[model samples]
Target: MTAAVDVRARLVDRLEASGVLTPGWRQAFLDVGRHEFLPDVFWASTGDGYERCDRARSPERWLELAYSDVAIVTQWDDGTSSGQQREPTSSVSMPTMVASMLRDLDVHEGHKVWEGGTGPGWNAGLLARRQGAHNVVTVELDAVVAAQAAANFRALDIAPTAVVGDAAHGYLPGAPYDRGILTCSVRHVPPALIGQIRRHGVLVLPFAPLFGGGAVARLTVTGTTVTGTTATGPFTGSSAFMRMRQQRYQAPPVDDYLPGDWPGDAVREYTTLNPLNVVDDWLASFVVGLAVPDLYYRRSNNGGSGMTTLWLFDTGVTSWATVDFVDGASRFEVRQSGSRRMWSEVEDTVRWWTAAGRPGFERFGLTLEGGEHRAWLHQPANPLPSPRGQD
Candidate 1:
């Protein structure tokens, strides 16, 4: 326990240095024990995949991880397979990210907070500890995970109203919250959630596009259902959070797009722009995703050849493209089929972004209104170019 405390002190110091852990959140972070909410076993990232860590077998390591900045996956396959499959359905988020989102939240004293993803209830515990447990309400989709988190809250001597249900719908019983935050990432900000936050109320969440990449969004509820609820805000920084359970992407298999041999109906071509540069960078993915919301991608590597293939597809199932990337090649072979030319669209979007000056995530913002989302640069009026327009 002493070692855990010491470890937490270092983490708090690190976060404070990072400027995300402000004075308002420092005490709650210090008081609320993060490890108390964690399960006996959790999965830690190993770059390639996840490595299981069990407290019973390695008590010291588990304790270190609990206080570390890294996220710990607590459930896999929604706990059906007990993490044997490594699907990462739920987790206690990284300390840095938790603090960053809380910073983005900018909560005030006596403010009623509604949290969408309870996970292990650590974030809610911090909020409860700061604002008083009665003022914080957290909802979780997985009943088993919620049950465990409730137990952990009691164990920590902190109790925030924990509801077991889909967070996307939000818990309306505690409506008109002063501030709201969602632990999970969403391609679309739920209208139901927007309705829960009072007008001018701040809602911090992760706004991810279907293409790839995501960032933390700090939105202020601007309008409500009388006209249509709208939450407009800028992304705070880069983030890689697990998708909201109901919002996870169920991508169609490659076979569904190509029923026969390689490039069966795809028109073969070549281009100088190597997608290697685009996919390797997060900001690139975010920009391209904003331009092409329905797009998604996959990568296949050639064994020992230092060569790769980047596959692009649209959610509408109308198009597919692949760029064969070879080292030191002046131009790469490209193939496309169907109504839309995805590779060409990517090439044009990349060029446009370059022409306009490469803007990072901070320059981008999102507006969710009338059951639709429009990502823009700098402000709401200047929306990202349409993928079709890029053609």
Candidate 2:
């Protein structure tokens, strides 16, 4: 066997030993050489650092990344491949995440699975190997990626039905799927998916809040309703699944909508809190907003007299806040003009969450009826009473 094949075998052995790979999955891993599914030029993450994989120029590096468990970012900011200048738009999810999602899916023999965001078709190949190629139907929004994935599957001799379309609608041609797994992160559960699932079918996906922070949720559909809880332990790794076309770009500038000066106190504070941390503590931000909606703030850093700006996009009609820090205190200046009172809304959301015993996102639930989606905090039977100041 070639060294590449040997490395693939070793990777499979590690997965099996880690208790993540079932016998069937192990066979699938061994059968499907990952190099066949990856691009000639891709990103490779090693323990030491990230390097480029060029099959034509650096075949050795390509083979190394293909056999490893790390995800290779395939598309950045749409489908342009100009080498790392654009933001990451899509990727083949890491092997551990794929395994965890598969375990959560719990696909059975002869079961039909509808997969979303077909990056390179490796996961689909695994499902096909376990449940038969005819049982797997995968969808991809980008025709280019879909075509590439089809080619990869062809190279592996697995002909799963790969469709080029919006996965947000769920591939309805193969409706009533016994299992539905989305390799991408979704801000909202599309109603179409609920309709496409067979009664009592399983749906495994990574759900992200509108403000941010994501968790893998395993839900069971009953009739047309779906219910589930968040998985314990953080799979904290990030995936670069393409954002829904409608939500792909950041909102337009907030300056167009903000008033020049209508704020009571524009308070800004500086700390080590990063964007990820802000997303995780969305409730805290919301609470602060409810108490002080009129307050505006911005983040800035000075490097030898040059200023860098950090803007909050979703907080109402504001585009960016002016941030200043001195003597361990921070202040923010809101620069938007709108009747909505973005700060107030945030505070209200925070207060709403806090009064309910500060229930974590696990207590939050979603119910989809037709095209409408309603989010609730706490269980139906023991719902927290609505706050009096709620709008």
**Model 1: pairs clashing at backbone N, Cα or C within 3 Å:** none
| Runs with alpha carbons beyond 4 Å of true place in candidate 2 | 22-24, 45-50, 81-84, 225-241, 259-310, 313-367, 370-390
Candidate 1 Cα outliers beyond 4 Å, as residue runs: 46-49, 225-227, 253-256, 302-306, 389-391
Overall local distance difference test of candidate 1? 0.88
RMSD of each: 2.1, 5.7
Candidate 1 lDDT, tens digit per residue, 1-391? 5887888888898999989899988888888878888889888775656768999999999988888777799888877883258478889888989998998898888899999989889999999999999999999988888898999988888878889998888788899899999999998888888888999999999878877789999989998655578889999999998898788789988888889888798999999998889898888988888889888899999898988999999887878999999999999999999889999889878998998899889999998888888889999999888755344
Q: What TM-scores do the predictions have?
A: 0.94, 0.76
The deviation in Å at residue 59 for candidate 2 is 3.1
Top TM-score model = 1
Q: Pick the candidate with the highest lDDT.
A: 1
lDDT of 1 at 373: 86
